[model samples]
Target chain A: DQQVKQNSPSLSVQEGRISILNCDYTNSMFDYFLWYKKYPAEGPTFLISISSIKDKNEDGRFTVFLNKSAKHLSLHIVPSQPGDSAVYFCAASAFIQGAQKLVFGQGTRLTINP
Target chain B: AAGVIQSPRHLIKEKRETATLKCYPIPRHDTVYWYQQGPGQDPQFLISFYEKMQSDKGSIPDRFSAQQFSDYHSELNMSSLELGDSALYFCASSLAAGRETQYFGPGTRLLVL
Candidate 1:
Protein backbone atom coordinates (compact mmCIF):
# COMPACT_ATOMS: atom_id res chain seq x y z
CA ASP A 1 0.00 0.00 0.00
CA GLN A 2 1.17 3.50 -0.79
CA GLN A 3 1.46 5.64 2.28
CA VAL A 4 2.15 8.86 0.39
CA LYS A 5 0.31 9.88 -2.77
CA GLN A 6 0.47 12.73 -5.26
CA ASN A 7 -2.72 12.36 -7.24
CA SER A 8 -1.83 15.02 -9.80
CA PRO A 9 0.70 13.98 -12.35
CA SER A 10 1.37 17.49 -13.57
CA LEU A 11 0.43 21.13 -13.05
CA SER A 12 0.95 24.28 -15.08
CA VAL A 13 1.08 27.83 -13.77
CA GLN A 14 1.85 31.23 -15.22
CA GLU A 15 5.12 32.81 -14.24
CA GLY A 16 5.05 35.07 -11.18
CA ARG A 17 1.90 33.38 -9.91
CA ILE A 18 1.38 31.25 -6.88
CA SER A 19 1.85 27.55 -7.61
CA ILE A 20 0.29 25.08 -5.24
CA LEU A 21 1.18 21.36 -5.17
CA ASN A 22 -0.65 18.93 -2.95
CA CYS A 23 0.26 15.62 -1.25
CA ASP A 24 -1.58 13.16 0.93
CA TYR A 25 -0.52 10.39 3.29
CA THR A 26 -2.45 7.42 4.68
CA ASN A 27 -0.23 6.45 7.60
CA SER A 28 -1.24 8.21 10.78
CA MET A 29 2.19 7.59 12.24
CA PHE A 30 3.84 10.03 9.82
CA ASP A 31 4.65 13.31 11.52
CA TYR A 32 7.44 14.79 9.40
CA PHE A 33 6.96 15.91 5.83
CA LEU A 34 9.40 17.10 3.14
CA TRP A 35 9.38 18.23 -0.47
CA TYR A 36 12.11 17.64 -3.01
CA LYS A 37 12.58 19.00 -6.52
CA LYS A 38 14.16 16.87 -9.23
CA TYR A 39 15.27 17.66 -12.75
CA PRO A 40 15.93 15.34 -15.64
CA ALA A 41 19.13 13.29 -15.27
CA GLU A 42 19.64 14.66 -11.79
CA GLY A 43 18.90 13.65 -8.25
CA PRO A 44 16.28 15.29 -6.08
CA THR A 45 17.21 18.36 -4.04
CA PHE A 46 15.67 19.24 -0.74
CA LEU A 47 13.16 22.06 -1.00
CA ILE A 48 11.22 22.63 2.19
CA SER A 49 9.86 20.72 5.16
CA ILE A 50 7.41 21.05 8.02
CA SER A 51 7.25 19.39 11.40
CA SER A 52 4.07 18.01 12.85
CA ILE A 53 4.03 20.40 15.75
CA LYS A 54 3.76 23.35 13.40
CA ASP A 55 0.90 23.82 10.99
CA LYS A 56 2.96 25.89 8.56
CA ASN A 57 6.56 26.76 7.76
CA GLU A 58 7.87 29.32 5.34
CA ASP A 59 11.27 30.02 3.90
CA GLY A 60 11.78 32.85 1.48
CA ARG A 61 9.25 32.30 -1.33
CA PHE A 62 8.52 28.70 -0.36
CA THR A 63 5.95 27.67 2.21
CA VAL A 64 4.88 24.23 3.41
CA PHE A 65 1.65 23.58 5.22
CA LEU A 66 0.80 20.40 7.06
CA ASN A 67 -2.56 19.21 8.30
CA LYS A 68 -2.17 16.42 10.79
CA SER A 69 -5.83 15.52 11.12
CA ALA A 70 -6.35 15.50 7.37
CA LYS A 71 -3.13 13.69 6.60
CA HIS A 72 -2.40 16.24 3.90
CA LEU A 73 0.33 18.68 3.00
CA SER A 74 0.81 21.32 0.34
CA LEU A 75 3.77 23.25 -1.06
CA HIS A 76 3.25 26.83 -2.14
CA ILE A 77 5.74 28.74 -4.27
CA VAL A 78 4.95 32.40 -4.73
CA PRO A 79 6.10 34.20 -7.85
CA SER A 80 6.98 30.91 -9.38
CA GLN A 81 9.93 31.21 -11.64
CA PRO A 82 10.96 29.17 -14.62
CA GLY A 83 13.61 27.50 -12.55
CA ASP A 84 10.91 26.12 -10.28
CA SER A 85 9.71 23.87 -13.06
CA ALA A 86 10.56 20.29 -12.22
CA VAL A 87 9.24 17.09 -10.66
CA TYR A 88 8.31 17.63 -7.04
CA PHE A 89 8.19 14.69 -4.69
CA CYS A 90 6.51 14.55 -1.32
CA ALA A 91 8.01 12.31 1.35
CA ALA A 92 7.02 11.46 4.89
CA SER A 93 8.56 9.86 7.96
CA ALA A 94 7.05 8.68 11.21
CA PHE A 95 9.39 10.91 13.27
CA ILE A 96 10.62 7.95 15.25
CA GLN A 97 14.07 7.71 16.71
CA GLY A 98 17.05 5.88 15.19
CA ALA A 99 16.78 4.88 11.52
CA GLN A 100 13.30 5.79 10.39
CA LYS A 101 13.05 5.56 6.62
CA LEU A 102 11.07 7.76 4.25
CA VAL A 103 8.05 6.98 2.12
CA PHE A 104 7.81 8.94 -1.12
CA GLY A 105 4.89 9.72 -3.37
CA GLN A 106 5.03 9.23 -7.12
CA GLY A 107 5.65 12.91 -7.94
CA THR A 108 4.06 15.96 -9.53
CA ARG A 109 5.67 17.72 -12.46
CA LEU A 110 5.35 21.49 -12.19
CA THR A 111 5.58 23.66 -15.27
CA ILE A 112 5.94 27.41 -15.41
CA ASN A 113 4.80 29.33 -18.44
CA PRO A 114 7.13 31.94 -19.82
CA ALA B 1 30.34 22.75 -1.25
CA ALA B 2 30.46 19.11 -2.26
CA GLY B 3 26.85 18.11 -1.71
CA VAL B 4 27.28 14.49 -2.73
CA ILE B 5 29.43 12.79 -5.36
CA GLN B 6 28.66 9.44 -7.03
CA SER B 7 30.97 7.57 -9.33
CA PRO B 8 30.38 6.17 -12.84
CA ARG B 9 27.55 8.32 -14.09
CA HIS B 10 26.43 5.39 -16.22
CA LEU B 11 26.96 1.65 -16.26
CA ILE B 12 26.07 -1.00 -18.82
CA LYS B 13 26.48 -4.60 -17.80
CA GLU B 14 25.26 -8.04 -18.77
CA LYS B 15 23.08 -10.29 -16.70
CA ARG B 16 24.90 -12.35 -14.04
CA GLU B 17 27.65 -9.71 -13.94
CA THR B 18 28.60 -7.74 -10.87
CA ALA B 19 28.15 -3.99 -10.48
CA THR B 20 29.34 -1.62 -7.85
CA LEU B 21 28.26 2.01 -7.34
CA LYS B 22 30.06 4.40 -5.04
CA CYS B 23 29.02 7.54 -3.21
CA TYR B 24 30.71 10.26 -1.20
CA PRO B 25 28.55 12.26 1.14
CA ILE B 26 28.82 15.82 2.31
CA PRO B 27 31.74 16.64 4.53
CA ARG B 28 30.90 16.25 8.22
CA HIS B 29 27.79 14.25 7.35
CA ASP B 30 27.56 10.88 9.02
CA THR B 31 24.80 9.02 7.21
CA VAL B 32 24.57 7.64 3.66
CA TYR B 33 21.55 6.24 1.84
CA TRP B 34 20.94 4.35 -1.35
CA TYR B 35 17.77 4.78 -3.39
CA GLN B 36 16.57 3.29 -6.64
CA GLN B 37 14.28 5.01 -9.14
CA GLY B 38 12.50 3.05 -11.79
CA PRO B 39 10.35 4.28 -14.65
CA GLY B 40 7.21 6.08 -13.52
CA GLN B 41 8.05 5.40 -9.89
CA ASP B 42 9.33 7.53 -7.09
CA PRO B 43 12.80 6.93 -5.71
CA GLN B 44 12.55 4.00 -3.29
CA PHE B 45 14.80 3.47 -0.31
CA LEU B 46 17.19 0.55 -0.45
CA ILE B 47 19.63 0.86 2.42
CA SER B 48 21.15 3.38 4.78
CA PHE B 49 24.40 3.57 6.76
CA TYR B 50 25.22 5.65 9.80
CA GLU B 51 28.71 5.82 11.21
CA LYS B 52 29.76 2.70 9.36
CA MET B 53 26.71 0.93 10.63
CA GLN B 54 23.71 -0.43 8.80
CA SER B 55 20.75 1.54 10.00
CA ASP B 56 17.70 1.00 7.81
CA LYS B 57 17.15 -1.40 4.96
CA GLY B 58 14.12 -1.90 2.74
CA SER B 59 12.70 -5.05 1.20
CA ILE B 60 15.21 -5.56 -1.58
CA PRO B 61 16.75 -8.66 -3.00
CA ASP B 62 19.69 -10.33 -1.27
CA ARG B 63 21.86 -9.57 -4.28
CA PHE B 64 21.89 -5.95 -3.24
CA SER B 65 24.38 -5.10 -0.51
CA ALA B 66 26.14 -1.99 0.78
CA GLN B 67 29.17 -1.00 2.84
CA GLN B 68 30.34 2.17 4.52
CA PHE B 69 33.93 3.25 5.04
CA SER B 70 35.35 4.79 8.15
CA ASP B 71 35.05 8.26 6.68
CA TYR B 72 31.30 7.80 6.00
CA HIS B 73 31.70 7.06 2.26
CA SER B 74 29.57 4.18 1.05
CA GLU B 75 29.22 1.77 -1.83
CA LEU B 76 26.44 -0.41 -3.23
CA ASN B 77 27.36 -3.71 -4.81
CA MET B 78 25.08 -5.93 -6.82
CA SER B 79 26.02 -9.47 -7.76
CA SER B 80 24.49 -11.69 -10.40
CA LEU B 81 22.53 -8.81 -11.84
CA GLU B 82 19.35 -9.45 -13.75
CA LEU B 83 17.81 -7.67 -16.73
CA GLY B 84 15.13 -6.28 -14.46
CA ASP B 85 17.76 -4.37 -12.46
CA SER B 86 18.00 -1.55 -14.97
CA ALA B 87 17.23 1.73 -13.24
CA LEU B 88 18.72 4.90 -11.82
CA TYR B 89 20.53 4.74 -8.49
CA PHE B 90 20.84 7.73 -6.20
CA CYS B 91 23.17 8.37 -3.27
CA ALA B 92 22.26 10.74 -0.49
CA SER B 93 23.64 11.91 2.83
CA SER B 94 22.15 13.34 5.97
CA LEU B 95 23.45 14.56 9.30
CA ALA B 96 21.60 11.77 11.07
CA ALA B 97 18.65 9.46 10.65
CA GLY B 98 14.86 9.94 10.84
CA ARG B 99 13.31 13.09 9.37
CA GLU B 100 16.33 15.25 8.62
CA THR B 101 16.91 16.68 5.16
CA GLN B 102 19.19 14.67 2.90
CA TYR B 103 21.64 15.99 0.34
CA PHE B 104 21.78 14.05 -2.91
CA GLY B 105 24.28 13.15 -5.59
CA PRO B 106 23.62 13.37 -9.30
CA GLY B 107 22.85 9.60 -9.62
CA THR B 108 24.09 6.65 -11.65
CA ARG B 109 22.17 5.02 -14.48
CA LEU B 110 22.62 1.26 -14.57
CA LEU B 111 21.55 -0.91 -17.46
CA VAL B 112 21.62 -4.68 -17.15
CA LEU B 113 21.29 -6.42 -20.47
Candidate 2:
Protein backbone atom coordinates (compact mmCIF):
# COMPACT_ATOMS: atom_id res chain seq x y z
CA ASP A 1 0.00 0.00 0.00
CA GLN A 2 1.20 3.45 -0.81
CA GLN A 3 0.89 5.50 2.36
CA VAL A 4 1.87 8.69 0.60
CA LYS A 5 0.75 9.78 -2.88
CA GLN A 6 1.53 12.53 -5.31
CA ASN A 7 -1.26 12.59 -7.88
CA SER A 8 0.46 14.83 -10.38
CA PRO A 9 3.35 13.33 -12.20
CA SER A 10 4.65 16.62 -13.52
CA LEU A 11 4.07 20.36 -13.44
CA SER A 12 5.38 23.31 -15.41
CA VAL A 13 5.49 26.98 -14.64
CA GLN A 14 7.04 30.04 -16.23
CA GLU A 15 9.81 32.02 -14.68
CA GLY A 16 8.72 34.49 -12.00
CA ARG A 17 5.52 32.47 -11.54
CA ILE A 18 4.44 30.38 -8.61
CA SER A 19 4.79 26.60 -8.49
CA ILE A 20 2.68 24.44 -6.27
CA LEU A 21 3.18 20.74 -5.62
CA ASN A 22 0.68 18.70 -3.69
CA CYS A 23 0.86 15.45 -1.75
CA ASP A 24 -1.49 13.29 0.29
CA TYR A 25 -1.11 10.57 2.83
CA THR A 26 -3.28 7.80 4.20
CA ASN A 27 -1.48 7.18 7.48
CA SER A 28 -2.65 9.30 10.37
CA MET A 29 0.34 8.50 12.51
CA PHE A 30 2.61 10.66 10.39
CA ASP A 31 3.40 13.89 12.23
CA TYR A 32 6.14 15.37 10.14
CA PHE A 33 6.23 16.21 6.44
CA LEU A 34 9.20 17.12 4.25
CA TRP A 35 9.99 18.04 0.67
CA TYR A 36 13.10 17.09 -1.24
CA LYS A 37 14.48 18.04 -4.63
CA LYS A 38 16.43 15.58 -6.72
CA TYR A 39 18.54 15.79 -9.83
CA PRO A 40 19.26 12.94 -12.19
CA ALA A 41 21.83 10.45 -10.80
CA GLU A 42 22.04 12.29 -7.48
CA GLY A 43 20.37 11.86 -4.13
CA PRO A 44 17.54 13.98 -2.88
CA THR A 45 18.28 17.28 -1.18
CA PHE A 46 16.12 18.42 1.69
CA LEU A 47 14.03 21.48 1.00
CA ILE A 48 11.41 22.33 3.61
CA SER A 49 9.51 20.59 6.35
CA ILE A 50 6.52 21.12 8.62
CA SER A 51 5.43 19.59 11.87
CA SER A 52 1.90 18.51 12.64
CA ILE A 53 1.54 21.35 15.09
CA LYS A 54 2.07 24.01 12.49
CA ASP A 55 -0.12 24.65 9.48
CA LYS A 56 2.55 26.38 7.49
CA ASN A 57 6.30 26.86 7.38
CA GLU A 58 8.27 29.14 5.12
CA ASP A 59 11.91 29.75 4.30
CA GLY A 60 12.87 32.26 1.66
CA ARG A 61 10.96 31.51 -1.55
CA PHE A 62 9.82 28.11 -0.38
CA THR A 63 6.75 27.53 1.78
CA VAL A 64 5.13 24.32 2.92
CA PHE A 65 1.56 24.09 4.12
CA LEU A 66 0.18 21.13 6.00
CA ASN A 67 -3.40 20.22 6.74
CA LYS A 68 -3.74 17.38 9.14
CA SER A 69 -7.45 17.17 8.75
CA ALA A 70 -7.16 16.62 5.01
CA LYS A 71 -4.10 14.45 5.31
CA HIS A 72 -2.45 16.66 2.73
CA LEU A 73 0.50 18.98 2.31
CA SER A 74 1.83 21.29 -0.36
CA LEU A 75 5.04 23.00 -1.33
CA HIS A 76 4.85 26.43 -2.85
CA ILE A 77 7.67 28.25 -4.57
CA VAL A 78 7.12 31.85 -5.51
CA PRO A 79 8.93 33.44 -8.44
CA SER A 80 10.08 30.14 -9.78
CA GLN A 81 13.47 29.96 -11.35
CA PRO A 82 14.77 27.60 -13.96
CA GLY A 83 17.19 26.27 -11.42
CA ASP A 84 14.22 25.07 -9.41
CA SER A 85 13.34 22.59 -12.09
CA ALA A 86 13.79 19.12 -10.66
CA VAL A 87 11.95 16.13 -9.30
CA TYR A 88 10.21 17.03 -6.03
CA PHE A 89 9.38 14.32 -3.58
CA CYS A 90 7.10 14.57 -0.55
CA ALA A 91 7.83 12.41 2.45
CA ALA A 92 6.17 11.79 5.78
CA SER A 93 7.91 10.77 8.97
CA ALA A 94 6.60 8.42 11.66
CA PHE A 95 8.19 6.31 14.33
CA ILE A 96 7.90 2.58 13.84
CA GLN A 97 9.45 0.05 16.17
CA GLY A 98 11.40 2.81 17.94
CA ALA A 99 12.94 4.26 14.78
CA GLN A 100 11.75 7.06 12.55
CA LYS A 101 11.58 6.33 8.84
CA LEU A 102 10.34 8.44 5.99
CA VAL A 103 7.64 7.26 3.59
CA PHE A 104 7.98 8.95 0.25
CA GLY A 105 5.62 9.80 -2.57
CA GLN A 106 6.21 8.90 -6.21
CA GLY A 107 7.58 12.40 -6.90
CA THR A 108 6.57 15.18 -9.29
CA ARG A 109 8.85 16.51 -11.98
CA LEU A 110 8.66 20.28 -11.96
CA THR A 111 9.90 22.34 -14.88
CA ILE A 112 10.38 26.07 -14.97
CA ASN A 113 10.15 27.71 -18.36
CA PRO A 114 12.25 30.73 -19.11
CA ALA B 1 29.27 21.06 4.77
CA ALA B 2 29.98 17.33 4.77
CA GLY B 3 27.61 14.84 3.11
CA VAL B 4 26.95 11.15 3.10
CA ILE B 5 29.28 9.07 0.90
CA GLN B 6 28.43 5.92 -1.00
CA SER B 7 31.03 3.76 -2.77
CA PRO B 8 30.93 2.01 -6.16
CA ARG B 9 28.53 4.42 -7.76
CA HIS B 10 27.58 1.70 -10.23
CA LEU B 11 27.77 -2.05 -10.09
CA ILE B 12 26.72 -4.72 -12.55
CA LYS B 13 26.43 -8.37 -11.62
CA GLU B 14 25.02 -11.59 -12.98
CA LYS B 15 22.10 -13.35 -11.39
CA ARG B 16 22.87 -15.35 -8.27
CA GLU B 17 25.88 -13.22 -7.45
CA THR B 18 26.48 -11.20 -4.29
CA ALA B 19 26.95 -7.47 -3.81
CA THR B 20 28.04 -5.27 -0.98
CA LEU B 21 27.22 -1.56 -0.79
CA LYS B 22 28.88 0.75 1.69
CA CYS B 23 27.96 4.08 3.21
CA TYR B 24 29.91 6.61 5.26
CA PRO B 25 27.85 9.01 7.27
CA ILE B 26 28.76 12.58 7.93
CA PRO B 27 30.90 13.41 10.94
CA ARG B 28 29.07 13.14 14.27
CA HIS B 29 26.03 11.45 12.72
CA ASP B 30 24.96 8.26 14.42
CA THR B 31 21.96 7.05 12.44
CA VAL B 32 22.00 5.53 8.97
CA TYR B 33 19.19 4.52 6.65
CA TRP B 34 18.99 2.42 3.50
CA TYR B 35 16.46 2.94 0.73
CA GLN B 36 15.88 1.31 -2.63
CA GLN B 37 14.46 3.18 -5.59
CA GLY B 38 13.32 0.90 -8.34
CA PRO B 39 12.79 1.97 -11.88
CA GLY B 40 10.09 4.64 -12.09
CA GLN B 41 9.23 4.23 -8.43
CA ASP B 42 9.64 6.22 -5.26
CA PRO B 43 12.27 5.26 -2.73
CA GLN B 44 11.28 2.47 -0.35
CA PHE B 45 12.80 2.12 3.09
CA LEU B 46 14.89 -1.00 3.58
CA ILE B 47 16.42 -0.71 7.03
CA SER B 48 18.13 1.64 9.45
CA PHE B 49 20.73 1.60 12.20
CA TYR B 50 21.42 3.78 15.19
CA GLU B 51 24.60 3.83 17.24
CA LYS B 52 25.95 0.70 15.55
CA MET B 53 22.80 -1.29 16.25
CA GLN B 54 19.86 -2.29 14.13
CA SER B 55 17.05 0.11 14.95
CA ASP B 56 14.32 -0.13 12.32
CA LYS B 57 13.14 -2.65 9.78
CA GLY B 58 11.19 -1.98 6.61
CA SER B 59 10.57 -4.01 3.44
CA ILE B 60 13.99 -5.61 3.32
CA PRO B 61 14.12 -9.02 1.76
CA ASP B 62 15.51 -12.16 3.34
CA ARG B 63 18.46 -12.12 0.99
CA PHE B 64 19.59 -8.77 2.33
CA SER B 65 21.36 -7.82 5.54
CA ALA B 66 22.93 -4.67 6.93
CA GLN B 67 25.10 -3.48 9.79
CA GLN B 68 26.54 -0.29 11.20
CA PHE B 69 30.16 -0.24 12.32
CA SER B 70 31.71 1.47 15.32
CA ASP B 71 32.54 4.50 13.22
CA TYR B 72 28.83 4.88 12.33
CA HIS B 73 29.37 3.77 8.72
CA SER B 74 26.94 1.20 7.38
CA GLU B 75 26.88 -1.56 4.78
CA LEU B 76 24.12 -3.43 2.97
CA ASN B 77 24.91 -6.92 1.77
CA MET B 78 22.82 -8.65 -0.83
CA SER B 79 23.14 -12.28 -1.83
CA SER B 80 21.70 -14.34 -4.70
CA LEU B 81 20.79 -11.30 -6.64
CA GLU B 82 17.92 -11.53 -9.08
CA LEU B 83 17.06 -9.51 -12.13
CA GLY B 84 14.35 -7.72 -10.21
CA ASP B 85 16.89 -6.67 -7.61
CA SER B 86 18.34 -4.06 -9.97
CA ALA B 87 17.75 -0.58 -8.65
CA LEU B 88 19.34 2.52 -7.18
CA TYR B 89 20.22 2.05 -3.55
CA PHE B 90 20.51 5.15 -1.40
CA CYS B 91 22.00 5.69 2.03
CA ALA B 92 21.09 8.55 4.29
CA SER B 93 22.33 9.72 7.68
CA SER B 94 21.15 11.93 10.49
CA LEU B 95 22.45 13.16 13.81
CA ALA B 96 20.15 10.80 15.65
CA ALA B 97 17.25 8.44 14.99
CA GLY B 98 14.03 10.39 15.15
CA ARG B 99 12.87 13.67 13.63
CA GLU B 100 16.29 14.77 12.43
CA THR B 101 17.10 16.05 8.98
CA GLN B 102 18.64 13.27 6.86
CA TYR B 103 21.47 13.83 4.40
CA PHE B 104 21.47 11.50 1.43
CA GLY B 105 24.29 10.10 -0.69
CA PRO B 106 24.43 10.04 -4.49
CA GLY B 107 23.24 6.42 -4.43
CA THR B 108 24.67 3.20 -5.88
CA ARG B 109 23.08 1.88 -9.03
CA LEU B 110 23.07 -1.90 -9.07
CA LEU B 111 22.15 -3.88 -12.14
CA VAL B 112 21.57 -7.60 -12.04
CA LEU B 113 21.62 -9.23 -15.41
Best candidate, lDDT-wise?
Answer: 2
For the predicted complex of model 1, DockQ is 0.82
Q: What CAPRI class is candidate 1?
A: high
Superposed by TM-score, candidate 2 places the C-alpha of residue A62 at a distance from the truth, in angstroms, of 0.4
The C-alpha interface RMSD of every prediction is 1.3, 0.7
After TM-score superposition, the amount by which residue B15's alpha carbon in candidate 2 deviates from its true location, in angstroms, is: 1.0
List, for all models, the DockQ compared with the true complex: 0.82, 0.86
Over the stretch B22-47, how does candidate 1's per-residue lDDT look in tens digits?
99999988999899999889999899
Task: Summarize candidate 2's per-residue lDDT along A12-93 as a digit string, tens digits.
Answer: 9999999999999999999889999999999999999999999999999999999999999999999899999999999999
Q: Fraction of the real A/B interface contacts present in each candidate?
A: 0.91, 0.79
**lDDT of each residue in A24-100, candidate 1, tens digit only:** 99998887889999999999999998989999999999999998989999999998999999999999986545786
Q: Tens digits of per-residue lDDT for model 2 on B6-103?
A: 99899999999999999999999999999999988999999999999999988999999999999899999999999999999999999888888888
Return the TM-score for chain B, candidate 1.
0.96
